[model samples]
Target: MQERLNIVPFVSVDHMMKLVLATGVERFLIELAAYIEEDFRRWECFDKTPRIASHSAEGVIELMPTSDGEAYGFKYVNGHPKNTRFGRQTVTAFGVLADVGNGYPILLTEMTILTALRTAAMSAVAAKYLAPKGARTMAMIGNGAQSEFQAIAFKAILGVDKLRLYDIDPSATARCQKNLAGMGFEITACSSSQEAVEGAEIVTTVTADKQYATILTDNMVGPGIHINAVGGDCPGKTELHRDILLRSDIFVEYPPQTRIEGEIQQLDPDHPVTELWKVITGQVPGRSGGRQITLFDSVGFAIEDFSALRYVRDRLKETGLYEELDLLADPDEPRDLFGMILRAAKPTPVAATVGAL
Candidate 1:
């Protein structure tokens, strides 16, 4: 019989890069979105809760966890807008997938890249149900680390390739435009958010600032427009003005959490908002009319990450892009953790012979 070793498959940053490159980026997002949508279709069967967060002056650290009866997953992630000054990423993350039967982690991965990918995928999935049919133009309001990914996701999933990019820093916009060159996008670098949103069928706000800054004004949103609100994910951070939320039909991943961390926090606690899962499951309407505005108040959710991890696990055997990590204690005899440690402290027969020589 094969031994049950105390090891898990760990996908490091290097391995993640290889895996993503090995599988084309667009194809990965499309496939990952399918996993996310599938989970939402069965949303009733999983454990759901608001992400537990630790906030500070610098930024926020959060744990997003969820499980279907048979499998469990969680991600440890941080959002620090000031990290760029120190030559670091604004967000960094890692996640684990485990078996619910025994609670042993099956796969562990670096989610800094995965989070960006999943966040973009989640936005596209919401757009699938809520965005206007045949929407092709998107206003990318923030050109930070997540902007390019958002653009690629929309293109891959929704066929949105006309991008109007904007940022407080022109350099960020330049960087975003340069990165996406020849990616089949009709690109425009706009001077202001108002200019960026002009004639756009969909708008995505993905800034990384950790404050209550309104990136979108009421006048910027128009009829038949879909807003992918991605940045206001913490208690005091927001992107769109409260007036905008009042006019739009809002959808979210989890309401208990969105009320505290999403754009809906600007509205009354009891204000009505539909869960995106419900729309995917066809329990409610998505776009009631071509003249009505829709908002996907997306704060990253555990279930989406759970789906992303599951997709990565499914691809491991075919890709061979992960490293095995000995991260658990599996004793030959049950309840023999101490004995296992003692056994490790002793030298092997070959080591003893080498010492004798």
Candidate 2:
């Protein structure tokens, strides 16, 4: 076995970008989805909980932790919807994976981009089971950094070929259109959320606001549409109206977490919502009929982050897109940590000669 204090693999932002580019974003999403699905199938083995969050007036900071008996993982993430005004990303994250045997981190990686990738992947996974049959078009209501990734993941996973884009900021929609040019998508930039969701099979609401703003009113939602609500992730944040939750068959990653953070927070605490893992594992039914509305109230869970971290860790060996970080102390003896620090304090021969002079 390798020494625990030798070095930990660190994947910085630049290295992560390189790895994603080399692997191809769509392919990476597909592969990452596979890992997530695999974990969900064996869901009973992992220790799960709602993410720990600290809310501020401007944003929220969250720590998501999980363990699967053998390995442990956690992610530190923050969300600030107003950050764009200062030319900063709305969400940024980093994650660590450690050995359960020794409690030492084995990998540390930037999760800002990885979070987007995994969120898209997780949405696609849910859509596969909950979306209408033969779904091809998706109305993307938010065209920020996560827009292209969501479009591509749906395309790669659910064969979605058409995209209708809209954003409160027209510039964001334009940027999304420019980024998705010639990506085999029949794209349209709509002027309003109503226009975007018109005649769409899947309506994805990902607007970033720290309030209970209704991006999609109940009147706007129709039958046979899968609502991928991604942005309403904090206590007071929500996208769809309360009536929409009543009419749809809601599916969530974890109810305890989603109840506090997801769109379903508007509903009763004990409202019936399907656990998504059960659907993936065939323990329950999804999309019972063409007219049934399915809502995936995604709040971003720890297990999804764990799956994404594991996927990146596995890929690092092949791509060599990581740096070795001296993140731990390597003492001569495990119990002599203080002695190791004291030994390093001894002067070198050059220092001793200069002192004598």
Candidate 3:
């Protein structure tokens, strides 16, 4: 009998590029948002754990793993804020998808570009639930690699027409504006964080600096604004004032993980917050009042990545793209895994003793 080996598929950035090109970024975002929402609705069914982290003087490396009984997935991501100086991105990542039944991987992919896409989709999804209805103006603080994605997601999902941009680096702001020009977005470059945040319906902070940066103080934020805290995703890294979290009704993707990585890390351990899934599943109220402030503490959860991967997988199906690799061991004799190796060894000509011959 032949062994039915479920082999893993190797998906590269080129495959991901095909996926993105086939589905289009906007459609992919919508589909990814739906997948993430569905996953959140079934949150109790999955096995969850905190990511493993390795820290260094320059940056940090992280591995986030999760399983849904049938499938397992993990992402290897690094945060090196100083990498930009070396002409590299602040964050780079890759991930894998596996079958839990046999402990065999199904796919491996470069997650740098995918992470940006999923993060933006996740932010948009959170804002869709927490933000006020018909919110059109958004202030993007700390413009960087993620700024354009956030802007595009907001534009596609929430119909945001105006953007007030701010960044510590003037070049970053210029890049953001240049990237978004002629995209039908009303762009306003602001001199200060307060100016960028002033009169905005939604405030998104996706800074790249690895510091406890208070980009937005309480005075800068106004009532009925939805704060998408994107950049403050790692420990000791934050953008909003602690008072902002205390005052606003905070929502997170995963509380246990977020408590350590999100902007809420600055708050008390018992600081009241609602899981975003609860709102999606109708277990909790999303927006209680129009004037009440809301904060979506986005730490880039694994489930969102899972959803994005699934979306990319489907997109790849139509384009006939992606290279398939043999990552799983498939021996003709499943029980004799050692036998396959023994068979491949070159047979040495046995030299008989002259007397024996």
The number of the candidate with the highest TM-score is: 1
- Tell me the RMSD of model 3 versus the true structure: 5.9
Which residue pairs in candidate 1 collide?
Answer: none
Task: Write model 3 residue lDDT over 1-357, tens digit each, in one string.
Answer: 112353455568787777776777778777888888888889888888878899999999999888888888899999998898899988999998777997877678889989999999999988889999999999998888898889988999989989999998988999999988988899999999888987899999888778898888988878888999999998899988888888899999888899999999998898898999999899999988989999999998888877776766655556766776656555455696786556547433321121122
Q: After superposition, how far is residue 17 of candidate 1 from its true place, in Å?
A: 0.7
TM-score of each: 0.96, 0.95, 0.92
Model 2: how far residue 295 lies from native, Å: 0.6
For candidate 2, report its TM-score.
0.95
Better of 1 and 3 by TM-score: 1
lDDT of 2: 0.92
Candidates' C-alpha lDDT: 0.92, 0.92, 0.84
Better of 1 and 2 by TM-score: 1
| lDDT score for candidate 1 against the true structure | 0.92
TM-score of 1: 0.96
Clashing pairs in 2: none
